[model samples]
Target: MGILKHYSGGLTREQFLFYEIRLVASLICENNSRDEIYNRIMQENLFQYPTERMIRSMTNICFKRIDSLASQMLMEHLANASTAVAKQINLYAIMRENGIVYDFMTDVIGEKMRTQQMDFSHKDINSFFDTLQEYYPAAADWSESTRAKLRQVLTRFLVECEYLDNVRSQALKPVFLFPELEEGIRQLSDETALCAFNCFC
Candidate 1:
């Protein structure tokens, strides 16, 4: 049985939305297949948290009648995002640069699940996540050589067209991964603030 199905009977729609919120938030830091991780997050957050089957049963009713409410989740999360993620909406730029990004990642994962009726092995699942690890160097402890290898992966992702434009832009920024946030942010600037200031003002 699907993991979400196991606990879905108990979760509220609000609670299930939280599951998705956490998945996206975590995905920004941890590079796994968003679709696979989303499924797991649903199972972990809604099914097992407060109770089982009850909230989920209620959610089914609410979602059936209020379709828009189902996707209002990202709004709730943006309300709670740290100043960091809210700094700039540059994910679109990255997605333009990268290709075949998240769309492919999710679709492939879904197809895999549909065929096997099970989630992937942890090792296999975490492989894509390593792609996002460089941004969180404290948690990642990645080597320069490792980063060189990862850049190749990133380049491949850019060549593929699955990721949305926003994700493609965000994927390459890794604002915190390159020692400090400010330094990394500077790297992404199209022109130096000083240079721009001198030109315009």
Candidate 2:
């Protein structure tokens, strides 16, 4: 596991593809400076609802994850694919990049799935958060409101990505990466692709 970074509180708390953010990130060129990208995105009105500050955070989150070929393909699917499932994968990537807390949560979920257990409870999540706090002091200081929101995000993540039937239910749904996409992921980074497969599917 990687060293957990302090949780930044800007992650959107709903299922969002951020199509506008994707449009903005697609404009990034190899030589574009930070100011250049920001100016261009503003001029184009790529994101308007969340205020400029939130837009910038969202943009940074999506932009950083697009370096690898697998990530690039995932972005393409997220941006252009019509299916909800494809967009779900895209959202997963967004959460993976932006939600530092989710990495730990997903690891626990993956382990449970391996044992043919598909149910989860608040105590299960809280226990993971407790363990997470050992490595991330910030987790220990979260307010009740923040902790509640994080729990909501976790359930929403599973539901939106088709991993769970619903937020209130625990039965896990089967998810499989398409062969072509899986091949692209492997070609780009075998280790990452394997981890993705185990964690999600």
Candidate 3:
């Protein structure tokens, strides 16, 4: 919910790596040091990402998203919650870690929901990016592929988190936050970000 000072294309690298995120959260819950976690992931191919380079890249992305949360309770929920709840928590973590996604959710997606506008399209995504470039001129430097992938990733994330029925439908779906997850978010004093989850708190 804080002001976005910059935009990042990190989401393009991975779109809601739910299993990988849960693994990282479980490792963190086990009190594994960062290096220990990274090494274990590298050695065991925990992410099953096909190659060393991919495994390393995914490990770094997972850590970047998970570490910024800095909430043991949230991590525990992500590691142990039921699938629906865990996915919601993972989406929350992503919004916290990625400003571009956070704004897209609250400003574009949330606004659409508020106006009862259910149609989501590539045009909407492009307009959002156009506005972002205006605010952060450096975002204009991203390659076209990067922008395309980001659009794909964000749409896929919305589907994964149940904010949309599916990519093809692109219809807004109501997201009712589990009480425990809502409480966990509140504990972080970031209840404002709950708008991204359709909580509108």
Instruction: Tell me the spans in candidate 2 whose CA falls farther than 4 Å from its real position.
Output: 1-17, 25-41, 67-71, 95-102, 188-201
Clashes of each: 27, 0, 0
With candidate 3 superimposed using the best TM-score fit, by how many Å does residue 88's alpha carbon deviate from the native? 0.9
lDDT of 1 by residue, 1-201 (tens): 101111111111222132333334444345455455445545766435465454444334323312211223322232344533321112212221222222223333333433443333333324644644443333256555544444444334332322213322422221221112223324444222211111111
Residue pairs in collision within model 2: none
- What does the lDDT come to for candidate 1? 0.32
Stretches of candidate 1 off by over 4 Å are: 1-25, 46-181, 192-201
Lowest lDDT 10-residue stretch of candidate 3? 1-10
Q: What lDDT tens digits, residue by residue, belong to model 2 across residues 61-116?
A: 55654442336566566555655645455544553555453454346665665565
- Model 2 lDDT at residue 108: 65
Report residue 14 deviation for candidate 3 (angstroms). 2.4
Off by over 4 Å in 3: 1-6
Per-model lDDT: 0.32, 0.58, 0.81
| lDDT for residue 100 in candidate 2, whole number 0-100 | 50
| Residue lDDT tens for model 3, 9-95 | 767767788999999889988999989988999898777767888887887877877776768888898899899999888887788
Q: Give candidate 2's total backbone clashes.
A: 0
The numbered model that scores best in TM-score is 3
